[model samples]
Target: MSIQKPGYKSLYLYLSLSMAPLFLAFTPLQPAYAEEIKNGKQVYEIGCAGCHASGVLDAPKFGNNADWLKREQQGFETLVKHALNGFNNMPAKGGNPAYKNEEIIATVAYMLSEAGFPNYADRTGVKAVTTASTPKPAEKPATVAPKSKPATATKSYKNTNQFNRLMAPSSEWNPPQSKDGIHDPENDGTEMLQKPRVAFEPLANSTSGNRVDWVKALHNGEINPRYDRVNPDAMPVVMDLNIVREVKGSMPNVVYPHKQHTEWLDCSNCHPAIFIPQKGANQISMASILLGQKCGVCHGKVAFPVSECRKCHSQAKTAKK
Candidate 1:
């Protein structure tokens, strides 16, 4: 007999390793019911309070039976469906998708019970109970007198010439530059600063009417007007200087930034002249611009294109003559 020894060390190590997982599996997990309800309440206050509290847009008011009863008539399942899909003004899931369907149901149930609906019950299985008791008032604290410290002396300055100094004119005062560049004693820096500050005046009455650049607008898919011909290589050059001058009237001729336009748009965007393609062509007019046609095609539609007189005409008002 070779000492008839039992080989238990290796077996013990193997059994210990196997039991580790079993021990972990049986460990008790703490309940999360209280924490879940706390979180649910916070979520409800932020997302549901807006419409539910005020009954906005026919929303069921919080703690109100009449409104909830009307909604419940449709049945609980239908109500949950409505909450998920959203009805009329109520955005789907109250516009917040982070809420779990279970949480929504639980919160709705809580709200129903709070509103005096007897049928509502806590799905979490927790019940709250109250006990009545007499309350006592808080006792007041005793008062004590405060000790006073000796006052310290402060230095004072006096000048006999104070009145004369007040009457004297300020030495920093300077005369203002007149309209002619010559300095005038009558008008001073005070008058210069008092003048109103210059402000930006938009070309049009409302920026809403202003149009975007044509090519840029087309490139942005803003305008989809028909084009007579599609020329990839062709750019939006000034078709004629004379036409621009006539259309602009008394205002400075807008140096149509054609290169800037072509960069963003295709020829088809403004081709056939913002009108149907006819060889001799259709007449583009100021009336059309106001109506959002031709130049109005994009001025207000997508590009800074408009026939509003003030937009272009008023530029001279702020310009240095």
Candidate 2:
């Protein structure tokens, strides 16, 4: 016990070791402001990434300084206003009305910060502070569910030079038929007709197409679309089957779910008429579909557009062992 270890501890070292806890206790730690930044990143992925990631509809690419700098030239407040409100081809809050003002601001800040513009959020005087003493989060809005409509594009389809030409933009989606470009505004009866939104709100929602999950809505008893116009009691001959069409190259194989289609349409709508019942009897391709044949007969017109490739081409191709 008398023989000490090889190393010797000085009196100063002992004192410093004893005070280490106090030193750490008095030291300042950064606030949990990263929470806001993380939320911003999440918001971008959920809503903004769809267009921004790929620069669809001329949206600024995520990390592109050139595109972001031009927008940054506009005052920060002005940029915030544009994001909060609709601007050009981009819809407000990237089409999700559910996004909070603070969240949107945070997201824009995150984008700008990541794109080589540091302290952009601070420039606007909005503090991104979070701490243990922070209050409970605000209660969510009563309209928690997404509105049963996609964001109406500001640009008309006729004028848009982008891909996915099927979707047209309108200031007022589901407007009164009289005001709707398709219907004659002079027709008094058109105005009397109920707005499409009013009828659609109750249906299950989707991100694309008419924004109504018509199949799910039917299954959930929200809508009972009559199979026959004259005979209201007529029921569809629902088929629960899937046909997987193998695609060339890296794209996933197409899985055509008959159950979804049959819930609304009869077999006669396709079998023998459009898609021949016999396998390999019918010739199907993207070219033909774009020409309004095969699946295109309904997809681009009534069902979800072909632009949503993952919806149909869902089956992953496995490597040969």
Candidate 3:
């Protein structure tokens, strides 16, 4: 025999025997890397944490197996459908419109896993099977009944509170009269003539003074009145002095609505000339407008007749105590 120094077959057998245990140790760990619950934690943190974290607005708290189990009994598919479509206070996709359906399912799985239900996939799979078994029949659309001809009653529908207030003929329908020569029937209302002119005087005086014509004070930049330009598009139609009297003892600066006047005029009608772009510039006085400076510019002439004292100074007509 030619002294073979350890043949190749013997070397191969020895190497295989040495590494067998190492291979056995890592084989069980392969599935862990293959199927990881991905982006589930991120989705939960951004979307579910808000209501679920604290049980806000009566939402179910996170990690509470009892709460989640109760919801689970409704079936995972039903719950998922609710989450996708929104149920009551819980907005759809938890109010994140951009979340994909796969992302939603993954997030639901993660939440279920965290709530001690690690076998979420098996449970959801069973739920899907059961849902598929009880197939619902397709619904037929409801047939619309033919519309009947409208009733010929002369009386209007009286269902609404608004109709109660407005539809009835006025017990007193007095036509408005003019001192000069301009009257519109559309403008013939107590609010247009009386309420607007009267209610806002005290609020005007709180900022300026009694002698100052309230309308002139607003136009001349004596009082910096703020208004709501938002919904219903509020303007200072008339300022109620009672509002001034209500808060005047505690807070000295409250202006009333000269709101109604602006309904007839444009923004440029009073801006720049009446109010400075830089706040707190105009200093107004009653004597100034009476001499035709600030409010006197229009109040006694084109806007309304300011000669009537009771118009602005009328006290709240108290019931005889």
Q: Specify the highest-TM-score model's number.
A: 2
**1-321: candidate 3 lDDT, tens digit per residue:** 111234557545544554575575442322122122224455577677878888896676778888788887876666665665567676655655334333345456667777878876432222322222211110100111111111111111121122333221232122233211134323445325653324444433421223345566666555555565455445555433222112212223324234545634554665678645343455443334444655566655554444553444344433332
Clashing pairs in 2: none
Worst-scoring 10-residue span by lDDT in model 3: 137-146
Cα lDDT for residue 254, model 3? Answer: 29
**What is candidate 2's lDDT per residue for 1-321, written digit by digit as tens?**
122222336434544554575555432121111233224666677668878898887888888889899888885556666676667776666665445454556677777876778866442213333321121111211112223322222211122344633333444456667444356555677778888888998999887777787878988999877788899898888789999888866889889898988878778878889988987677676645755788889888988888888999999998632
Q: What stretches of model 3 exceed 4 Å from their correct place?
A: 1-38, 121-321
lDDT-superior candidate, 1 or 2: 2
Instruction: Report clashes for each candidate as comma-separated counts.
Output: 12, 0, 14
User: lDDT rank, highest first?
Assistant: 2, 3, 1
Candidate 1 lDDT: 0.44
- What tens digits encode model 1's per-residue C-alpha lDDT throughout 1-321? 111222457435545555575555332111111123222244457568878989886788988988888777776656655665556666544655334344444456666666776565543112311111110000100111111101110100122123542222232112123321233324566346432112112111222322223344555555554433575445443332212322333555333344454454555666655755453355544544555766676666665546455544333322434
The 0-to-1 C-alpha lDDT of every candidate, in the order given, reads 0.44, 0.63, 0.46
Instruction: Tell me how many residue pairs clash in candidate 3.
Output: 14
Local distance difference test, candidate 3: 0.46
Better of 1 and 3 by lDDT: 3
lDDT of 3 at 175: 22
